[model samples]
Target: MSELCRLWHVTVTVAGEEVEPLIVRNALRRLSDQRPFLHSLKYAGGRAEIQYWEEAESLLDASSLALRVWNEHRESAGLPRWEVVGLEVLERTVFLSRGMEYHVIVDLHDVTPLPF
Candidate 1:
């Protein structure tokens, strides 16, 4: 099968509980810096948005990379580990478009005591 290249809108959300917007913004910035693929990083409706190119050898690889980013960010950030309930990476591709779209959601719940 031929490899397909597409543009992706990667998103990570820390939802379920109220968090200071400033904190989220700072975390997003740091996350962006950790991931070189992200560009034009922004936030909307409590979600971190980034424009990236899914140029990995396979779609699975691309998705895996997104997951890794989420895990890494969560581990590094002073956030509850169990608070994260979901991590989603959706494809928002347009027909006949040169690249496919991607959206990732990292859901978080209320703060909890760190077990580690």
Candidate 2:
């Protein structure tokens, strides 16, 4: 089989209240918690992001889970919708950690943003 690697780095931007970002962050945390396979979300380059090892076996499933959070909170967040401008797929080998970091979202409430 092809070497499994989907070290996805997704960025989402919300178009409403400042708390909107938190909504997305929290949802992602919950998602990672539920699936245990999907890693927690992160913030980078003025966007909320995440990286996972594609343990879901299907990138589409991973992508859907990311979008699902926005759908679940669209109404209450006062957000018309969130925009996923890009899902930056990269070679897993690029990360110094060598993709050994497909970890669960630990604490979204206090995650520092990764420098762009």
Candidate 3:
């Protein structure tokens, strides 16, 4: 039996040329360091966005982490602060028919938490 694990997907957007991939990666690392509950670091699109998984016990906890990362970058002047535009339990099952991988569907919880 496959073990059921809670996962979270985080998407961060920054200008193509203005943002450095290393810096963004560092930021994600910092976030993960600060909160050890998350795992996996998959970066894509010229440092434009990143997605990772987290052991989210609830939507609120997951949302908090997302908000923190966004604010941290904004506070550090890493990127123009973008509000929590959207978040929700990702319902659709994503699969790569021709790849060495397996995919898991997560409960996407959309959150537009008020800025702190």
Candidate 4:
């Protein structure tokens, strides 16, 4: 039987040498523009949090991709040369069960840039 893909919510946090806040913000905005599926982005001068959904056959596959997201987009997105400091991957159902307050309901078509 073919493995069925499942949706996994991924949150990746990266941190490195500090840079200007505007530079980080703009890079994140560019990243969001390039990857519209991103649910939300939050950043400071030295760190950032990226949230999105990944469709894969297992948590391992999903987390693997999540781990590479930053480096893969670094050049095109102009993201900082940072190290991924944290990662969280949860099945879609489990993610939602965490309650409304823990997440933001984002309309993919209308993503707004948020400040740190």
Best by lDDT: 4
Worst 10 residues of 2 by lDDT: 9-18
Using lDDT as the yardstick, the better of models 1 and 4 is: 4
Q: Candidate 3, which ten residues in sequence have the lowest lDDT sum?
A: 107-116
- RMSD score of candidate 2 (Å): 6.0
Q: Please give the ranking of all candidate structures by TM-score, highest first, separated by commas.
A: 4, 1, 2, 3
In candidate 2, which residue pairs clash?
A: none
- Where is model 3 more than 4 Å wrong at Cα? 1-17, 44-69, 72-80, 90-116
Which lDDT tens digits does candidate 1 get at residues 85-114? 344444445422533322222222212121
- In order of listing, the candidates' clash counts read 3, 0, 9, 0
lDDT of each candidate versus the true structure:
0.46, 0.48, 0.43, 0.84
Candidate 4 global TM-score:
0.86
Off by over 4 Å in 2: 1-17, 20-22, 44-46, 55-80, 94-116
Q: Please report how far candidate 1 places residue 61 from its true position, in Å.
A: 1.6
Compare candidates 1 and 3 on TM-score and give the better one: 1
List TM-scores for all candidates, in order: 0.51, 0.43, 0.39, 0.86
**TM-score of predicted structure 1:** 0.51
- List model 4 lDDT by residue over 35-87, tens digit each: 88887788888898888889999999999999998999999999999999999
Clashing residue pairs, candidate 1?
6-99, 6-100, 8-102
Candidate 1 vs 3: which has more lDDT: 1
Better of 2 and 3 by TM-score: 2
Candidate 4: C-alpha RMSD to true structure equals 2.9
